[model samples]
Target: MKKHLSIFKLKPLSMLCFTFLILISSCKKEESDPNEQLQDGNSTVITDLAGDTQAAMGSATPGKEARPFYIFLFRLKDQKQIWIRNATDSAQWLKGKDWDLAFTGPYNSEVYVNDKKYRYNPGFEGNAESAVVMLEQQYDLVDQAPSDQVFDASTITKIGWASSASANGWFFYSLSTHIMQAIPNRTYAIRLPDGKYAKLQLINAYKGNPPSVTDLNWPAPYFTFKYYVQQNGSKNLKTK
Candidate 1:
């Protein structure tokens, strides 16, 4: 037995090499690409707008109500986003200065736009306090324009009657027109502060899993919309 030496014996150097290989393998498994977790594309989904009936009616302060209109912040380059309750009590306004775009609404089914706080009134046009520009719809152009096309804000000057009427507001169930509902496939476009373009289409405005009027959850005024922000610095709707 003393005359034979087995070459198959596990040497200390072999053990060390084996352990080093395992360490390298473990490190590789732990490593991950940073971009893997990031959201791809230039689109975002905003599932809800914070304000309830009491908040919309101006009965309660911005953040004190059960629900409050949200101050949406949209940036194009990196796609940074922020959504907060509109602060009506302060002079700061619901529209943030750093924000490229802002939206407020579902107030009686009417959505309002701050348009970068460009001095637009949310009330009826021709009224002494009416805004210079309001969010309106163009039924004829709906078919003409591509569904994903971006829209110019300069083109949206007047508040359409369908968007401001009683019982038949822009997106309520009582509206006679099907396009007026905040239902799926209804798309809207807007121009950003830097003259860029963006588009939004409703997904779900009701509460609960399936979404229904009976599950409306009035006090919670939830809103959901899919939005796309144009990366190029052009006003062209077709450009991404």
Candidate 2:
């Protein structure tokens, strides 16, 4: 079974303990803000993030200026992926906002999903509740590569961004695959407090599936990632 973080309000002492644990777990030392006049420089085109090793956000579809957090993703009540914006980076369009973290690949794996869901192995592991939150470990996402190259799963990767909030840590969906075999590649382009953009990702990384899935099921609630959206009509980076 996976660990589940109760959303219940913590008492003073419990809250303090949790905070202490978080501090000890984080692995990344904070960095100074990287905001400067962009000068509207020329945007470059990257073939792939994983394969090329040196590509970045360019003039792709709607990810204008390489910002994909504005990139969106969603599902209808019927569970079909919905279009949240008019951008090529649709994957993150609706991200950290209206939806719980879902599988990154397309939903064509419904058969595998259903099979895995109903398997009732009872020994399955991994979930937000059970996620390992090192006090200060840093992380980011991989970019969209060209059709020719693909993201490999063996090296540590990194990226950065001007974020909407102070919260930044490695996020894992316990249901992904095997942890060691799982791919830890995800990139982000965040708008800083000064309206300038930046990028971020994990320090050391991997390319593999989620952890082992022996017996898995849930009770009351399923563990997953939280989302963020603007409460003031305009994009609000404030943490909820």
Candidate 3:
């Protein structure tokens, strides 16, 4: 007697479903990789975090300019970015320690630490103890933060474009070309309000973090930067 043979096969509909599932999986993996590998091979680096992408094209008035530009507030601990619509209301932001860094002023280039006691700061009269100090070293090379005494003695609030010293801030403006460019090798070492330490690298201020932007009308205020926060309450910020 001959034995009967039977074979199971996938139907056309089942084959289609299997292909769709594979495509969905591939898309999810691409979206999940939002971070780049650090040189240290142990730490991950956040990449291309875009800030405010809107531009302040002044109102219909001929001579009157836009009163307030939107402020982009950031928290280093969770890597959260909030856009403040009501730019003038300091009470909302100062109500709590929700923000660590702020991007305000034209093109959202003027950055500040949420130091409440500092006059003219967004957190004025509040309880935040955050302070910022400019570091001359590159972002990846900064292994440690400056001493607390140095942060206590700092007086800088704005860390964006330097009108006087071209190399002082994160970016420089070309007077002849009327273009703004992010200066290379500029990083900020910040003292968080909770006394934690962080180092920030402002890579670009224009859209896509382009290497070279020549047009004055290029989409801007979309800041791209990376930062590392030391969660252990120590100054060891070795990203590389």
Candidate 4:
């Protein structure tokens, strides 16, 4: 007991008060309450889970599938999609062996209320010459080409969107490559949320997971890929 000289056994003063309260909670700096995130209305982290906000930007959905795509008539408000090129309508484009020709039904899409019939089912192809080069390069669709316009290889037309979403804003096609390889194809980074990241790929594909030399992989198949991204200007991501 004569050796007891401890002042409440202070183990170096409780390790310097637990390292000074963890450096004062790591420099106590918290005051970014910008109206608490403008009233906390958040939701934007899907950089393409097949990203389909039903074609954002005001999102009408009066029947769906209306996203910038046109040719000829340009001024705004156009999303046609009629059919019936010819089962006898003079054998126009409705005749096929591998692709093309009145591919979708004929009519009655709810009594054609503002028309919208992107037929060509099964894999899609309503006169698919790359779908008329993505509907005649709707306002240069950001980056489009297939001979940049003038695709009248004997046509008939049923229509395919346009007149809005920022001057004909829709173009997606992939017979295997080009069009920036089809949006974040393999996706190595896409994080976004302030931390920052967006990198995407597919511009030429051929890097890996790809076999079968050129038939594009199975049974003479050729659908390639497609993509779309329009954040801020109204979050649109046509994830391929």
**The best candidate in terms of TM-score:** 3
Ten-residue segment with the worst summed lDDT in candidate 1?
Answer: 123-132
List clash counts for every candidate, in order. 5, 59, 1, 6
- N/CA/C clash count, model 2: 59
Model 2 stretches astray by more than 4 angstroms: 1-177, 180-223
TM-score of each: 0.46, 0.19, 0.74, 0.17
Ranking by TM-score: 3, 1, 2, 4
Residue 43 in model 4: lDDT: 21
Superposed on all Cα atoms, model 3 deviates from the true structure by an RMSD in Å of 8.7
lDDT of 3 by residue, 124-235 (tens): 7777878788888888889999999998887777687877554467878777876677776777898988889988877777766667888876666666677778889999
Name the better of 1 and 4 by lDDT. Answer: 1
Tens digits of per-residue lDDT for model 4 on 37-119?
A: 21212222211111122232233554444442110110001212233323443233222222211212111100100111334
Against the reference, the lDDT scores of all candidates come to 0.41, 0.24, 0.72, 0.25
Q: What's the C-alpha lDDT at position 125 in model 4?
A: 34
Model with the higher TM-score, candidate 1 or 2: 1
Worst 10 residues of 3 by lDDT: 1-10
What RMSD does each model have against the real structure?
A: 13.7, 20.9, 8.7, 20.2
**Residue 80, candidate 3: alpha-carbon lDDT:** 78
Spell out the clash pairs found in candidate 3.
116-123
**Model 3 TM:** 0.74
| Clashes, model 3 | 1
